[model samples]
Target chain A: MSRVGIRELAAELGMSISTVSRAMNARSDVSAATRERVTAAAERLGYRPNQSGRTLRRGATGTVALVIQTNTARTEMGETFYFNLCDGLQQTLATRSLDLVVLPVGASADRDRFLVNAVDRHLADAYIVSNTDRTDRRIEYLTQRAVPFVTLGRGGAADHAWLDLDFEGVAAHSVARLAGLGHERIALASDDRDINSTWEYACGYRRALAEHELPADGGWEIRVPDTPEGGTVLADRLLDMSPRPTAVVLAQETLAIGLYRRLREAGVEPGRDLAVVGFRKNPVCDYLVPSLTSFEVSLVDYGRRLGEIVIGLLTASPDDEPVHEVWEMTVVPGESDAHPPCEKAAG
Target chain B: MSRVGIRELAAELGMSISTVSRAMNARSDVSAATRERVTAAAERLGYRPNQSGRTLRRGATGTVALVIQTNTARTEMGETFYFNLCDGLQQTLATRSLDLVVLPVGASADRDRFLVNAVDRHLADAYIVSNTDRTDRRIEYLTQRAVPFVTLGRGGAADHAWLDLDFEGVAAHSVARLAGLGHERIALASDDRDINSTWEYACGYRRALAEHELPADGGWEIRVPDTPEGGTVLADRLLDMSPRPTAVVLAQETLAIGLYRRLREAGVEPGRDLAVVGFRKNPVCDYLVPSLTSFEVSLVDYGRRLGEIVIGLLTASPDDEPVHEVWEMTVVPGESDAHPPCEKAAG
Candidate 1:
């Protein structure tokens, strides 16, 4: 049987092609009864819309783009995470026959201009923004342009759809675990960036310290670049503290391995000398000498949820509320975290 | 100053628009002198062809796509490498006002369909293929379609452009170094995949062994999945050998950490009990207890070279020779590879 077009369907239903098109598009101008009638006839006649023609008419490209900016200053610690997430997103999008286009932006300053050009060219129907800062201007720009987007991290206004990692929960859990292990003087290593995740992690650390009745030492919280070199530098500073921290929490898991190496070189065993807790669990964590104590979040689920949220936003009516989700991670305990030597000896 | 259009440039040069377009496109129908004259006039007049209009006329998208299929069975070891390479390619393309699109194909079976759809829709002007097999069907498919492309690894015919790592050189160098250290029973850990790199690495290993007058042990050439789990399995197999190999060479660096862990658990110390050498030097290599002795390739340079090859292929005349380049990697020795205990005692 030949596939029926909108024109054929309209003729069969004794309606104009414009009316049928409007009904198919869910336009408000079409009456509910007429839309139901037109839809039923179209379905019965096996009417399939021409993809290219529909795209031209609706200005929808049937593609979603993820723009990533390469930070030349530091080695990216989240490569595996991003790759896994992209795979998950692609899998989810494939179900809807939507293509995922990843655009790598080389220069940080050219990101906005590149995105604007992509949008103006009708390259994609929606976008997935990542590496968000606390006060990201891209959020405002995209909002003003009325482009449908979902962010991997929190940054934009509450009205925008976003799926952020539960950094606060991770911090709170790490602090509480260390406190349980009789660690009073604990240090936190965080990324030296304006990203919202860093702020959230800091907030959780401070709040958990208060809850545990631990004094907040200003010098204990160190900001460093997320790299092995940064971890080595941090190791020196950590050892130089007046009352050295018995336990250290990393905001990023990538630094854990480096910290271990630096500490070992200085004759400090990771788990026995200073308990170490990482933010995320990676394959490398399993191979660390003492094994890194870290949290694990299902990246596949996170990405799939993001895909669903973005699809929801794109297909929703204007009056519908934007979706906001925060995913919590589970901590995977390893030998890297243990009671301080004094506590262990006393026990 | 305002940008000059092709029409205005044609009028100024007193040539028909079609003639000017053909000359600018470097069509065979246009004389060499006419083509040069047209290009010179276009440059002098500051004539910038409208991007969208030119794309429609030439059936080009002004974009290059790298389609990567996710390997579900193994933990992706080359994530950082690919990410870094993509960044470099994007940087190179940005100079020419060309966009790089990354299309992630989830399932292996879906790869061909995805590429077909992408090409049929005119999503990109060219492609960058990676993780090539010895008998890759994608090469045939793309060549038949007459689409411009470049591969990161060598395969298909000599008529295609490819920039491949010097796997054979690496293997030869590793074997020679081990032989010089008086180790006659050196094992080789290679990928089980039917890829060209694996074959090349095996070839290099055998040739080097023959040159060194070392007896070949069929059981020493172990093939395993390129993952940490695979490393653990290989470790067990290596230990089970009647006369365990003194040293081992890994095709992938990510497996080194896991092998170290397994060896340690069995009361074997890496660099002491068994010397190990890895293929690539990554950030993880530095964090391992004894560190890893591996080859280091400038990923940025590799990516830039791949970008140049693809750009060259895209712009070259049909009769021009296809570029084939092989990049040699430098060995960064760490504690991972050392003389066997017997050899050390003998010395």
Candidate 2:
């Protein structure tokens, strides 16, 4: 955008090009007074180095590759969450002239050959991992190559730079909200993506039970695929329980939606027969006979934070501390959870 | 993905490389029979022209850039319709081995420069328009240069391939649906960005009303921005009408959401006091106090169709006829529409 070079800036300021270059690169040889003069001249001239040449000279391209795995069925790739995060990421990266390469990163075919061939081959400065599991080959390869990278959710360990939603708080809040309505029996339709998000949220549910001094029932956890069909299957299985869950806290909206359809087919009223809550208050949830109560995460903000981290990683020295960002979730209460166990409520 | 060469195929088929090359290029000297034989062998051997040499030779890369405009306030980029359209576009183009260069075409500094300048400099073969309007300069400049282009939606009278949604069908359906529910008086909320869609739909609405023997009333069309606050303003204006509309159809989900909120605050239930329907259903719409009924369009399919057209144009002769495509919209019924007025049912 700035179409001016350092030589033009130096010429305008009556300063030697070498002195200006050193100031721009932050060299110690130039005195502070001269550095200020050089900086001001560069700023006034609106100088921007040729991006391609600068990136080539430097070791990285200052661009990050967002590798969304589309090999196996991925929850993030197929859902609204993926787009919102990318949208948020664009908001953050577009400002810094950084571009996101949205390529299917899975090695399902020759794409895998491209990913493992070389990080430098892709000309990316850093890698951003999404929809990957605890032992993903892509993350393992990136770490081995010593390339800067960030993950949306935890990838194996907490050592890498990441920004994750508060999975625990969501479970805790659901429990509190349901208990306040005098509901004793609660169940969870946990997401089956990476064990990380599901495990964390399940762990949080246990923690909340301990904090509230409530019993942790074995009937609560149902590990199901992160699709509406999977939720329907889980719902069928739950109905076989000695005392079916009075309230359900499904980890994703697709599950909640599937549950609604299955329940309707079974001639059951949602708000009256069962109370439900889920993550990702998906927009379609409210259109169900009884809407779902769920938590809303800002994917745009998440992507923006990821962008900031990538930009920071791109411009900062290799030794600069990695940036870590964490955003919480907001609860969106819907009609599905508006009823109590004793009597269904009407507004 | 095949990465096989024509020369390699020629060697395997025991044919002269020059003859094979001539056949592949469709040279007039090569007989039709020979050309068919050569093409069959090439397909069998999975021979694709070397992209590097082709890119250098024609000054055109077999890549179409999709420039999506990102505004600060527009965060619902993950809307279901966009994903579906993009998916559709990708699916159609994948067969041709053409790549879609996805980038956020936003304003840098105060000036909005189309990244067309970036693509025009031998970066891509064509430009695929996404989320562009009638006053777009991209259409004008690209047309002057005679570049192969396609649009998801039309902008003015540009000579390019395009695939647009049937807004007229959407409008007709909304009216017919309301009429089936016995709604006589109605109002409409139209989004500013979706003028073309609004225009077609409005005409359809009028046509449908005339067919139903319902008279059009003045002060029934409410202009609104695509936001919750805009919905609020439109709702206020519509509610204050001398003979208030029993139903409303909106061009945007945010506006419909605002209307639902406004009605709730004024102690009016959505289905009881005002029936509502919207286009461009956002993720948060289902959770709105009354889930919105609306039209659904697939953005992924739209993107895919545009991609396919670009590939077709690029691979064909220079005088190839531009391809025209239009995707249909289906109704997504929610809780907004009520049967025979909720007050009458209550009585």
Candidate 3:
């Protein structure tokens, strides 16, 4: 069935196209009586305004593009993160009658090329860039084009609106918690990716160690793949250490599950033999023999904050400063790090 | 900076709007030399055709929407399922220059209302509706309107294209596997949702029981929420059974995690005390104390098949048959169902 266009609706109502358009748009210039008649007639005739036509006239797509990384080695965590975040984003965007369009860029695809096409095609009024890296060319391109965009994570781009999780704060707190528990040689398992959060996490780990007057053991700050398999690799590395670190902080909490499994297989028990702190408390952490000590991030609320900031950036004038903020993560204590270092490990 | 418009490009090249438009569109009427010159100048001036304008002219949105449910109680599994499926969908759609837009419907929202709005707004050239119910109003509405759409799961819609997983086959296979091991009393834990798969699973379980000459015990069939917490609730219910079931099959594998935890806490080891079979093997199943016996679904390949079917539907003539297919699931052997009923329970 073909949609009834504005021309047909106007012809049926015996009214001018401009009047029908204005009435449909709910413009104040159209008299209330005429607006009601036009609305009734349009409804009766099933005449919904075409999005493309309306978008061309208004210079607004009534859409926001959320660019995310997909087809990566690890997908569950990232997909879950965005899925929850999208709920909040959708709820918030609904208030303004804007649709959220997710543009999933394959891991192997050229990220900047995808962004360029989206921009050139005017796919959305604004864009939300996720899985950010330290030197992001996408952010740079958006910045140069003066397009409205907000990054889910901050990068090296200059003076743009961004909302990032408090990875640094979580790292510092986890280090302090372990240090106060008499853990001197605390290890840090950071993601090998050049993600901004990884860098922040490493920085916080180093700063906390310095504050504790502990030697910066290069071997303790090993970067590995941010996956369950990588967690097994990390466990192997820890076992290879002559005097293993008493405690470890994992930047990617996903690694905790594999770490626990591998450690147990090696006759080492988490919370009893070694202390572990991870980011993101989830099902795996909850079901682990000894619950994992991890940080809890309310992704829905974070998504809402992102939506608010995106709206702010879109509506704000040029003189208004671009917002930059961090979302705090709360620590959910578990049995994974219940004890201090074992006596034999003091050496 | 403002985007360079077609009018400005035409003015700069001293050509008519028609000539420039035809050249940019690569019309055969335009000489190759002129087409090349127009393309070079357009590129140099950064004059890309507006998507809205092009869509209005061509009457094709060049977008395919994948609608999925979100914000439900059992989110991890659903999110993971769609996330993996989307990768294949996107990869296949990319071949035809069609962008996949994910429209996540909130669990609490009116689903029909969402679909109506999406349809009214002409959101995409086609849609892939997922989480199908037995009598889906959205499918009915889409079918009535003659909208181009394909469901991810089969529904009650008439003569429509659909691709569904073989839930019936999986259920039958699981029942036979346990029944073959000399288990007379078997239980089936099905999802409480009104989804079509749940109905098929229940049917298969009942049919299998009849074929094996075992009583179709009403008490053995229970419908529960499809979440880990639901799994805990299911465990409690099973423990309360007067003559507990010897083996069980779970329609949703997510419930297996919590069931394992609760059962272990109750001093009833899964594989030793009672046999368990689950659907969709994953990390939890792999890491379970006794690996879960579950079906392996290659979601990416399933997604690719869906993409192929959708494209077929879109390009096929009216006289052509509407495609309907069921994807087969493979069983992954595990230790969860390593034995039959214990000797003491034989009575």
- Model 2 agreement with the true structure over A258-342: per-residue lDDT tens digits: 6776776776667778888887766445446566788876555556667766665565554445544445667988888897873
Q: Name the lDDT value of residue A81 in candidate 1.
A: 68
Chain B TM-scores of the candidates: 0.79, 0.74, 0.80
Off by over 4 Å in 3: A1-59, A76-78, A345-347, B1-59, B76-78, B343-347
Model 3 residue A277 CA deviation (Å) reads 0.7
Model 1 lDDT tens row, A203-312: 89999999999989889999988776778878888877756888888987767766877887887778898888989887645567687888877666566656655556
lDDT string, candidate 3, A170-204, tens digits: 89999999998988889999789898989989888
Query: What stretches of model 1 exceed 4 Å from their correct place?
Result: A1-60, A72-78, A107-109, A340-347, B1-59, B72-78, B107-109, B156-158, B340-347
Q: TM-scores of the models, in the given order?
A: 0.79, 0.66, 0.82
Candidate 3: residue B39 Cα off by (Å): 40
The deviation in Å at residue B133 for candidate 1 is 0.9
Which pairs clash inside model 1?
A: none
lDDT of 2 by residue, B142-217 (tens): 7778776677676567467665677666777888898888888867777766435666667878888887777688
Q: Lowest-lDDT window of 10 residues in candidate 1 chain B?
A: B50-59
Residue A290 C-alpha lDDT in model 1: 83
lDDT of 3 by residue, B207-242 (tens): 898888877788889888987788998898887886
Model 2 accuracy (lDDT, Cα): 0.63
* Candidate that scores best on lDDT: 3
Write the candidate numbers in order of decreasing lDDT. 3, 1, 2
